[model samples]
Target: MIDFQPISPLQRTWLLELGLERAFLARLPQAQPGGQSAPVAAPAQEAAAAMQTAQPVERHLNDAGSPSPSAPAAATDAMSARDQALAVLRKSGARPVAAAPVEEVVQRPAVLIQPEKAQDMASLLEQVQACQECGLHTGRAQVVFGSELLSEPDWMIIGEAPGTSDDRSAKPFDGKAGLLLQAMLNSAIPNASVYKTHLVKCRPLGNRPPTQEELAACRAFLDAQIRLVQPRRLLAVGHLAAVALSGRDEDLETLRGQALTYTDAQGRSLPLVVTYHPASLLLRPQHKANAWRDLSLLRELQNQP
Candidate 1:
């Protein structure tokens, strides 16, 4: 039997806005003539079908980065993630306005490990474990690199930085947050292979935020991991991970629930989305509605080839 947890009124509103209310209220399984259970209702099936067939919505911009006449009008809450992203872009004066500032803040470090130096994920792991790029490394109990890389992961989950449990376990996304993350991911994309990592490898002292210099220091390692894993999509949880991965320091509200892109050193691009961290969600249950919307966006991306 499928267990259906009761959802909040806010969550109901979110589902209604996204046309997913039926999916949540999908009929329970019933026994068939041969004692076999009937297939799950079309509500869930249709949702999955929509996810599988939904093409990314695109909008063209003029020379000044303003939306062309061909661009779609303002997207409402009901619009798809891609549509919402395009809408957000349109409102922000699109890329032409924001490009220069973004580029200015996102500069490469003076020195980083070359691809030739860390050829594969294994070699990169060794180098990362020995990383001493920033002061965070000095007070760290262990460098929480990440889980083992999936040769071809469907999703690459990036978190802000290591927490207390992570530092002790020498793993990224540990304890309650990790469990919640896993549950959420599984709910969205069951059996889909995922690789988890953090923006910064080592934990900061007393849980203070890592400095900008520290994030820059370990940028190469993160980039290398992305290159090696080559995941189809990236889900950056929390403001710091979103900032580090997207190369944009916009507010989390401006960043989340939108279809973004992340480009690696090799120029390979992947679909990216930012959402509230699971830890944050734990503290503020109200935000799970927003996170669910982000997950729906992620599910849409995963459906595409």
Candidate 2:
């Protein structure tokens, strides 16, 4: 018969120094005080147990904590390569070896267009047409500026970028998706008017994902639109739009129906809401329930006195 022993104070202290808790040290035979048998855990079993125990901490430490459903394979490959390099160095008996710093590479500089400060919409349109700060500018067929009434609007909707139809039309939110977005707004605000725009001006090649650079380069234009509209409420659609506006990569699931605040050009705090993109909803109809909830929250906010 085997009996388990309690952990030693010295070993518990060592494990604690390594960022592990005394409870975890107590599970390991090496840390256990002498005189009793301990149940040996297989390496895989030990790893599984550790993972289960540390899951919450791991989530907090991760940048987004949740996997992006739309993350590209190339990005995953890059991450794997980095992990492999670190592993090889560690296994090579390299003394004092440290993991490389994960530098967030920005593909391009962001632009800030404060349309409220602009002389007129025509001039803002001209500026958007000529802007070329990212590689997407070269690949685009046309630029999608934005659409809004000449008069002031109560609501403003922002999306990630131009799709095939939008790229060809140079209009933000055209086609079935546009129709759906309009319907959603009309349902919520009955008599209220809503403005629409994209984060990036140009359409990415082959409808490929917009890189960080492309989003950054066009940030100014979106910012400018917000300043000009000064809408009572702003709705950021899509993961990219949410991240661009919030300055954080939070999952749409967690962000939906939640109210956030963004600083406008005048540094005024603007109320913000996040929702699934019309395009995404078209792809995954199941998310429409959540979208409806978000839209309902937006309606409630707008109706608030």
Candidate 3:
């Protein structure tokens, strides 16, 4: 079963005003011929379905960035993992967002990835929405340029890619996982505003892992964000996130709780830590303690001379 991140009461109301989300939009066309309320849900489904059927995908990476035989380990149990992840969140003081209906999401015409020059964040975001660097853009609703860039942030959090709700809201890390992250960040580092974004801006149909070609195409864009943001530390969640950010293909579980470093194209060395994806935390919530250890180490690094 697909799990949507709970949103705040206010956000739920806003989503409602936006015009019925997935479930409501699914029944749109049957209502009226000329007046199907929103275009976001329909086009996404159409284009995504077409892509899913038409292209011969590298199934090894289905649902997470993987070329491994087991895609994010499919044999894992869904029911118990979700329950454990929820318990971890509740213990961490997560503020759950109640469910509400919503309308259209941000949608735009396809554009090409801008030439690789140092453009400001706003300019880069506009260009990314149009970027067609890889096939992932085929069914994209919008580019999650990431949360606002701070002048100089200490931590830059990254995940594999946007999920369904993130695609609709045009916000990275904006689901149940996001609420869990917020709870962790707030309690751990109250004064810091960590910039978060995804390795792939577009959502792969059914939230599968991105293919190698997709990762290669988007690498330049992420590299650009890292350089521009110049974050002091990197918080990479999940195997794919760690691989892309660290440029090391170590098993995610193996790399967890270790001090990892990423060297940018410009030769700047940034400290990074790998941990289970927030979604995975929902899957294997016992790993939350391990993630907490990683976070503690990040703080230690931040205070280092």
Could you give candidate 1's per-residue lDDT for residues 262-297 as a string of tens digits? 998878888899999999999999999989999888
Error of 1 at 67 (Å): 98
RMSD of every prediction: 30.5, 22.4, 27.0
lDDT of 2 at 51: 32
Clashes of 1: 0
Candidate 3, which segments miss by more than 4 Å at Cα?
A: 1-115
What's the TM for model 3? 0.62
State the local distance difference test value for candidate 3: 0.68
TM-scores vs. true structure, each candidate: 0.61, 0.60, 0.62
Which sequence of candidate numbers ranks them by TM-score, best first? 3, 1, 2
Scored by CA lDDT, what does every candidate get? Answer: 0.72, 0.68, 0.68
Task: Tell me the tens digit of each residue's lDDT in model 2 across 1-305.
Answer: 12223344553443344344444344445433455646432233333333333332222233764445565443333333223323333454343323356699878644444444566667676667767677887888877888745466777888988889898887889988988888887787777777888888888888776888878777777777676666777789998888888777778777777899878767888789999999888898998888888888888888887
Give the residue spans of candidate 2 off by over 4 A.
1-117
How many angstroms is residue 163 displaced in model 3 relative to the true structure, after the best TM-score fit?
A: 0.5
